[model samples]
Target chain A: MPKIVDHEERRKIIAKATWNVIAREGLGGASVRSIAKEANLSLGAVRHYFQTQEELLEFAMQLVQEQVTERIMEHIQSHLPPKDQVLNILMELIPPEEKKIEMQVWLEYISYKIRKKELQKESVHEVIVEILHRLQKAGLLKEDILLEEEIVLLHALIDGIALHILMGLVPIERGRIRYLLEKELNRIFVE
Target chain B: MPKIVDHEERRKIIAKATWNVIAREGLGGASVRSIAKEANLSLGAVRHYFQTQEELLEFAMQLVQEQVTERIMEHIQSHLPPKDQVLNILMELIPPEEKKIEMQVWLEYISYKIRKKELQKESVHEVIVEILHRLQKAGLLKEDILLEEEIVLLHALIDGIALHILMGLVPIERGRIRYLLEKELNRIFVE
Candidate 1:
């Protein structure tokens, strides 16, 4: 009998390999051949999971967003206080020790998405909007600021922090970035 | 006698080609061979001007920075008023015109420098420090904020705005981004 592969397990393995390729060589290097080599799978086997490079990249990007969301939700659940929940959500976006590579990969993917219009699908916008709504509903966001400007500022703040950390300009302490975020948040939102 | 080539003109041609490649195909595609093709020069001719790809890229990056600095300074000099100078500096960073391509290329180069440690030379740091110092000396920056934090926030603000413009989430209007920048500046600097 032929050997059976657990579909979900295989998907996870491929996604992890995709992240590795992105972290090691950037989004440009996350080609099918490179990812297959990184995953220790044949080209055919990699294609068996992802039909094309775009499909693979889209899946990887989705996985990254989902992973971040999952961690944020989990952290918020553990902390009952809204302030702590907000703090945890910001923390989840920073370079978690074990997930640093994933964060790096996600940054590259987002940069790519910015230049490439086809990549800016509704799903990505939805994810951003959903996060903005959550923060607002939690009353963690400033009510005085327009929701659009606040959303823009929040995204810019996070991206700015991520860029600095990745560039080694700022120390990679979650507390430092979170503190900065809190300061900015307080400037806009009433306590 | 062999024909003489205008060295300065040749250099400008090559640099323009480099920018074109970066705008079209990104930094990864701005290889020596590809740049030569874009310049319509033989590889040997291109090499005659730039000894190596690294040298070529460094010159191109510096040129982009200089162009931006020149524009900002011109606007400052022409405006005479400090508030207008500050507004012009912020407006110069936004996209949706000829400068849009330059901004895109600069973003790519900045992100590229993050992954490549060898590219982080003293000159880059010096340029950043000088810009920060000039802005602070102009009394445009908040006095209470540490200089280091001020520098970081400026970078974040620019990067954030650039990313949003590139992502199409924010409309590329001089008034829109400028208004946002002015608001943030007021919050940070003005009482």
Candidate 2:
């Protein structure tokens, strides 16, 4: 009997390889052939899994979104208090030492989508908005806080810090990121 | 007598053309040929002005930084009060409708630099830090405000909002941006 190849597993393997290529060479250099080589697969194999470059890149982006959501879900299910739990989720969005590759891939994807003028709705922003709403309903946010404006500020601050960290434009250590984030959270969250 | 071609003017024109190409095709697609074509100049003329792509891009980035610095200086010199002066300078960093192309080119340069591991010191961050320190020295900031932390937060928030607006990930309008920024300023600045 012929050997059975797991198509789903193969697709995921290809997507992860695509991420690596983007992290190293940027989205512009992520050609189908290059991705296949990085994945240690033949050109035909990659093509069989993804017909076009756009299709492959789209799948890669989807995989990244799903993985990030999974991580966030794990944090939500943990036993930490809501405040620390929220802080942890925000930290997850900003890449630390190990998560660097993943976030770098994400940044490239964002840049590509922006240039193409086909930017999809950023799910990260929605997650933040939803979390803030949840906290407000639980009476954890300060009474004087304008919910809508706070949402906008917090979202922007998180993304801006992430970009700065990624670029190494500012010398932001992990402790500093935590401190800055915790301070902002304290400003809006009820003590 | 031979026609006198102003060397400085020609170089500036080439740099502007480089910015236009970067804004439209991204840094990856910015080539000497493309930039020359965009400038409606001959290839030899572009080569005469900038020897290599790196030199051309470097000159282009310098022009952007200088232009931004010049605008900030103008804000500093204006008759607006300290608070309004700071707000106006911050607004200049975030691309208004007319400043979109310049910021687009800047974003592309940033993305490219990050990939190449060549990110230089971002002058904008320094300017923010300096301005905050000056305000605190003038006793304009709240007594309880942590100067260092506030600086980091403000820098991140501004850049983050700029990124979101550029990407259209959030429907942030000019008024909303001003409101969000002013509110943050209110939080830190003494009434």
Query: Which candidate achieves the best DockQ against the true structure?
Result: 2
Candidate 1 scores a C-alpha RMSD against the true structure in Å of: 3.5
DockQ metric for all predictions:
0.43, 0.59
Error of 1 at B116 (Å): 2.9
DockQ of 2: 0.59
Real A-B contacts recovered, model 1: 0.34
Question: What are the per-residue Cα lDDT tens digits for candidate 2 across A1-191?
Answer: 98799988988899989988877777667888999999999999888867765676787788888888999999999999998999999988887767766767777777667777887678778899899999999999999988777777888988888888778755657788887788789988887
Tens-digit lDDT string for candidate 2 (B10-76): 8789889998887766666788899889999999998886766567667778888888999999999
Q: What lDDT would each prediction earn against the true structure?
A: 0.69, 0.82
For all predicted structures, in order, the TM-scores are: 0.82, 0.89
